[model samples]
Every structure is written in structure tokens, then in C-alpha cells.
Target: MNKLLCSILLATSVSFAGLISTTDVTVDGVNTITKNYQFTPNPADLGDLSHDRATAWGISGVSLANGETVTGASLKIENLRNWELNEWNSLFIDLLWWAPEGVTTYKDQNMGYGYGKDDDYFVGKESEFGTVNLTRLNYNVFSGSDGMYANPSEGVTISLDGYKREGFNKIFPLYDVTIDFSDSELATLTSYLNDGNFGLGIDADCHFYNDGFNLSLTTQKTSDVPEPCSLSLMLIGLTSLGGAFVIKKRK
Candidate 1:
């Protein structure tokens, strides 16, 4: 290979940034039919990592294809742990398979996870950025290190750009929003959302990603209905329907 030509190609490739192809599989209502992303890393970069015991773990950024081209992918996890079961928080995550990237996240990513910050003492957080209930575990998602959890007001919409600038960029790669709390859900969601742009806010720096993700799940909140906010939607819908009926009657 010509040294000068190789350098030129590399530079040009980096400048364009490729795209990741995502796909979705339909199942039914209320439940999902897919999860996770899949990608084939550069043969050279794949190197010995695939076989390296030390490198045996979840996917990495290097897997991302050049020009937005992704070599692998993950769920857009936000508040990714909850339900204090035993002595650790139940890990949480979201679906990112439908995000603009060609990758199957679950089968490829889950190969390496569950090794806690200190020994195997906690539930490893999973994908699909959504509400979690880690209070049961008694331990925060990130205790020793490389741990993070989020709690959020379910059904609410938020802009992730702020979270991105604040370090929640990992969860914002795709614009698809998921609301799940189980490992299965994580894998399912990531696989289904393989090509969507979900605005997720995950702060992956701290061993705990302690960005304060507060979610008002039904388990914790005594009242399902928050006062002053109940009558808004139903009332509006009913009123519109009534007006339409009256107009029809006059005609």
C-alpha cells in the first residue's frame, strides 16, 4: 500500500463520518418485539481484543463505524438501576437497536457485563434509558466505580442536548425513548430501537454516573394521580368531542 495514499484516504474518511443502520421488528402492543444493536468491527481494529480475556466485556466506542459508521452499539440507559434486591440495585437500561446504526446490541454487548466496581457485588446496569427501581437493591447502581443509575418522572419528555453537554451523551446517540426496567426489556428495546434517535441522558463518567436522575415510578409514589394535573387531558378531549357533536346536530 502507498503510504501517502493511505494517509489521504484515512483523513477523508474521518472527515465524512459514516452512518449506522438500525432496524425494528414488530411484536404487539404495550410489549416490544426487539432490542440491541449489531455491528462488525474493522478487522484490523478487532485485533486480539475479541480473544483477549482482559478485553472480554461489553462493546466499545471504537466499534462505531467511521463517519457515524458504528461497529457495535448499546441501549440508551438513563436511570439504569433500582429495586434493592438482595444487596445490590437491579440494573436498568433501554433499547437502541433502531437507532441510526447497523448493530445488534444485546447478543454483541451482553457478552461482557456484571463485574461490579469492587468484586462481583452488584447487579450490572443494562440498556434502554428509562425509569428504574434500585431502592430495593439497597446499593446504588454505581458503588465502587463504573456504575450509574437514573430516576425520572415517567411519561415526561425532556431535551437531551442539555444532558449531553452535561455528560449524558451516551444515551442521546439515538432519538428513541424507552421506559423499561428489566434486563429482557433492555435487550428487547435496544434491538427494536436499533435505528431510532431516542434522546437519552446518561452520565457515564463517574463510577456511578451520579447525575441525579429522579424518576417518579408507581412503586414509590403513593398517589398515581398528581393533583392539579389530572383534569387537563381528559377534560380537553371530552370538550372537543362535545363541540363536534353539537356542530353536527345543528347541521
Candidate 2:
């Protein structure tokens, strides 16, 4: 009995250690799913008020089952370049979602007359300069609204001064920098995901090119249960201990 109990204890400890080693429980362990999206537009498409300008891409391929909750999220911007020489330029970024009676949507330049672009230009519908419930992630100098959307009480600004141009034709590429979402932002994203509508928009004040972008989301189930591997280890330990007791009784 003493040997059996020792064996079980050792097995349980090893199992838990193995589980902790392989999983980040803080981020919800194996329940996390990260999706990367590419957003390399034509150089002319961005940074130009005329010709090809302002673009929005819908976030797709995210499938979460009922009761699963979004715990964390992030956005990765790659190789953002500024065209101005020795002058700081600002890039506007918006997190877009569908809302009833909402004024924000992606508009193309070829949409014709009366379809003028918004102040932010990237995530706004024709002539509509602000988002519905969503907010701008980056500051918009042109709007002079100080990062607030049409709703002045909402929204937050993320500065990218590190990537801005410091000299003539200077390019500061951000390869590994990831913008982590706050708790409130993650909650908003969860709501958007629940509603089946989400998008990311990008627009630059001066000549700039965004090499690409990647979005990541991590989610976990509401119920807390032991992982499969840990459960298996526990079961095996119990089985072994049971067999040992049976042998002792027979002897």
C-alpha cells in the first residue's frame, strides 16, 4: 500500500509538471488559436488621397464554438514605411465591426460620385467619417479629433512613432512587434466575433506603405476541465494502484 501510494503521488506530480511545461495556463493553455492575415497593398493604394487610396480587409476564418470566450488578441504590423523626409507622418488604423444603423464600412474609390472618402479614409463608408461602435487604434492627425471616432467618448490611440521616418527616404521595418489588445478591446472583439462581423482598416497621412499585417486571437472554453494528457496520466496511475492492491490481497 505504501509503495502504491508513493507511485501514484509520483505519477500525479509528473503529470502536472508535464502539463504545465507544455501549456501556458495563463493564456488558457491549448485553447489558443492564432490566425495570420496578409495585407500587402499596391504602393499607390495607400498614402495617396487621390488615385488608389484607403483599404479595408475583413477578418475571416475564425471559428469559435458556443461558450468559448476570447481571452487575448493581438495585431502585428510588418514593414510600415514612411515616404516623408525628416518629417513625422501618422498612420490611421481602425477596428471595424458591423452595427445596425452604423455609418462605417469599406468604400472603394471607384464607387463613383457622392462616394467621397472619410477623414480616416480607410474604414469609413461613403462620406461617413467615423465608425459605429468600433474605434480607431492609431491616432489620426488629419481628423484632429485626437483618436476619438464619431463617438467622442470612445476609442484609444496606439502610437507608431518608432516606425515613422526620421530622415530622407528612411524606412524602419517592424518585423516582430505585436500590438496586444487590452481587456476592454478583447471584450469588444469578443462581441464582434459573436456577432459575426470584424475587420481591420489602414490609412496613412503621407506617402507610406504597409508591407503586411497579421491578426491573432486566443480563446478558451468557459468550463475548466483537466487536459486529456493529465487525465490519462491520473487514470493510469489509479489503474496501476488498483492492480497492486489486488495482488497484495491475493498474496
Using TM-score as the measure, the top candidate is: 2
Give per-residue CA lDDT, model 2, range 83-194, as digits (tens). Answer: 4334334445566553212111233343222112234654435222223323322222344312211221232323343444446755443223356667777777777667
Error of 2 at 202 (Å): 1.3
Error of 2 at 90 (Å): 1.9
lDDT of 1 by residue, 36-125 (tens): 232232221112222111111112222212122222223222332222212332222222221112111121222223324222111232
Q: Which residue runs of candidate 1 sit more than 4 Å off their true CA positions? A: 1-28, 31-36, 42-46, 49-251
At residue 23, candidate 2 shows an lDDT of 27
Structural similarity to truth (TM-score) of each candidate: 0.17, 0.47
Error of 2 at 240 (Å): 29
